[model samples]
Target: TLVKTKGKLSFQEPKTKGSIRTIKVPDLAIQTLKAHKLKQKEIKLAASSAYKDHDLVVANWTGSMIDPADINADFKIACKFANVPQIRFHDLRHTHATLLLQLGENPKVVSERLGHADVSITLNTYSHVLPTMQEDLAQNFNVAMQNIKKKSL
Candidate 1:
């Protein structure tokens, strides 16, 4: 579902304007996905005629789309097992954006990575993460001032 449509909410493909994006994944994620695909293939063979294949990277035992409730329940169980604070699945997006901003990535790049409508939206959502950038700017200004003083001497 498009979260911010001025007209009407529609159940369409996610390839809307400015929403479609490609992101690079690390080797660890690639390895995990490959392992998951192999496991899914095994499951498909075991289920045989009962299986309903959706070609999903994340799906039910029979390869159908998983229900939201099931996801929430499983997430909670996993969090408890890992001894981590419970967070909603949606929170992962926020975490990703925050980490990128904190790591000094350009806001526009982060915005595009997140598939936001524009950089302004990304700035509005993550401006708090720019305090580190401000500190870096201050240090750079001090270095420039010191260089000018040495040149004058």
Candidate 2:
């Protein structure tokens, strides 16, 4: 990640091998991304000769790396606009993991998305949400057994 300072931006590679894995995005996200790409096309046309064609998914209209401070400021403004609690940009990662776990996504999948070295880390980090998932699983099992018995008769 690169952080923009007054004079320059700093860059560094991931500290661990686990951070290099790809994330599987859902269809809805792909759709939204396509829409965003279309918007970027409009922006590129507007910027015309000045736009750098680096092919960034998220960048300034001139196709430059956006400033970190600007991203944070925009995030804060968006939070206010959406009437959500004020949270730092880093908090979104935690929120994404928590919401997905609570919604019963596979722990291994979540771990991969989070770039955790192993699934155990994801399970341990979100163990509090597991009890409810366990209960739901048990209920689903009961329903399945009932359906089997009815079909057998």
Candidate 3:
């Protein structure tokens, strides 16, 4: 939705007033997408005459927009199979942001990838992740203060 691959998917305007963004896909998701693409191609060939044609990244058996409800149902089933915690689909996005922030990633980088119009948008959306970094900030401040005091002495 952010990067237009071959101009196939273009975002002429931001989703919101502050929504221009680009993001890197993790290796796992990329690989999974590749696999899905291959499978989709196969399915498309096999059922070319049986279904309507659409080139969506993901789709239903009939090559149509998968209903939002169906997606949630499938997500829940997959989560149950994986023994994952009871997090909503939106929670996955939060988890991704939280992990990146906790890992000390640059907010600018993360925010851009999340397709936020600006760093502040990304920061605001994931502000909860910043609290965990307070300890690190405080420790650095203490060290800097001690250095200044020693120099003055």
Candidate 4:
């Protein structure tokens, strides 16, 4: 993709107008990208005689468009080798959304990242986790009630 930056870096376009957003990268991801960029530069220079600029973050060694199917296949094999249980690559998206909800992220924030039609989608998908959060809140509610009762006496 073209480097369509707003200020410092560009990102994949949101699927819809409602979906457009900026996400902060973790420190580890930033450092990893720096190392990867340096290595990519070396690789490109070495293959300069045959390389073509494809402008993708990851591509075939000859700088051509990497087949999506081949990448998926490779990913599957790597997942299996790493002893990860079977899960679709798409599942990672769902996993991320669920993790965010478990961490008590605002539903609106999680919804935007997943490019959901709305926050309701994020809530519905994670209602099971929400119930546990409600249980924790109930304890706080009880404490508040006790405090109010003591004040009245």
Candidate 5:
């Protein structure tokens, strides 16, 4: 995580141990990141001595950290160009969690992916999705029982 203290920027540990985790990325995302890395490499070659080389996945053309405000501004422009509704970048995290829960993904897995301190936090945060999951479970149970009855017959 990045911390801004008294007019200085620095990297810091996550707030909780749980927050330090590896996440699975989709193949498409991996490919995109690889392409971005190649582009960054070219930029580094061009910048030579001028490049700061903080080794960030995302950085300025000169390989320095991009300010958060600059990121937000770019995000706003991207949203506009994409014809998407304006939303804070952080909202993407909530959307990802909610979508997974709604799709009936295991709460524990989702919690781990989100680096939540506990599964209960994922359950509580996504309680609104549970009712649909329960309905699906009941339907699946009924189907299983029907199949068993047919096999017995």
Candidate 6:
């Protein structure tokens, strides 16, 4: 995590032990990141001695850490260009969690991916998604019973 201390920005350890986690990235996202890394390598070569490699996934043209404010500004512009509602970049985390829950992903897995200290926190925060999941569960159960009956016959 990035933190500002005395007007200087620096990386810091996560607030909780649970925050240290390995998240499973989708194949498409992995591909995109690989492409970005290749592009970054090209940029690094172009920059030559001027490039400062902090090994960041996202950085400025000269390989310096991009300010969070700049990222938010760019995000806002992109949202405007895409004709989407403006939302804080941090809100994307919540959206990710909510979408996963709605898709019937196991809450424990979701909580781990989210780096939540406890699964209960994930459940409480996304309780609104549970109703839809409950309906899906009922439909799935009925299908399973029908399949079992068909097999027995």
Which candidate achieves the best lDDT against the true structure?
6
**Which tens-of-lDDT digit does each residue in 42-76 have in candidate 6?**
99999999999999997999888777888889999
lDDT of 5 by residue, 46-113 (tens): 99999999999979988877777778888888999999998777778888998998787889999999
RMSD of each: 4.9, 2.7, 6.6, 6.9, 2.0, 2.0
Clash number for each model: 0, 0, 3, 0, 0, 0
lDDT of 3 by residue, 67-145 (tens): 5556678888889999987667667877888788888889998886666778998888888877878887898899999
Per-residue lDDT over 1-153 for candidate 4, one digit per residue giving the tens place of the 0 to 100 score: 223344333446556776566778689989998887777778789998788876756766766665555667887888999999767666777888888887878899888877788889889888888887888679879999999999999
Q: Per lDDT, what order, best first?
A: 6, 5, 2, 1, 4, 3
RMSD of 3: 6.6
Predictions in order: lDDT = 0.81, 0.87, 0.76, 0.76, 0.89, 0.91
Scored by TM-score, the top model is 6
Candidate 5 Cα misplacement greater than 4 A, ranges: none
Error of 5 at 146 (Å): 3.5
**Distance from true location, Cα of 87 in model 1, Å:** 0.7
lDDT by residue for model 1 (1-153), tens: 322356443346676676666788779989999999999999999999888986778777877766555677898889899999898767778989999887778888999988988899999988888887799879989999999999999
TM-score of every prediction relative to native:
0.78, 0.78, 0.71, 0.71, 0.85, 0.87
Whichever of 2 and 3 has more TM-score, that candidate is 2
Candidate 3 regions exceeding 4 Å error are 1-14, 17-21, 137-153
Roughly what TM-score does model 1 have, to 2 decimal places? Answer: 0.78
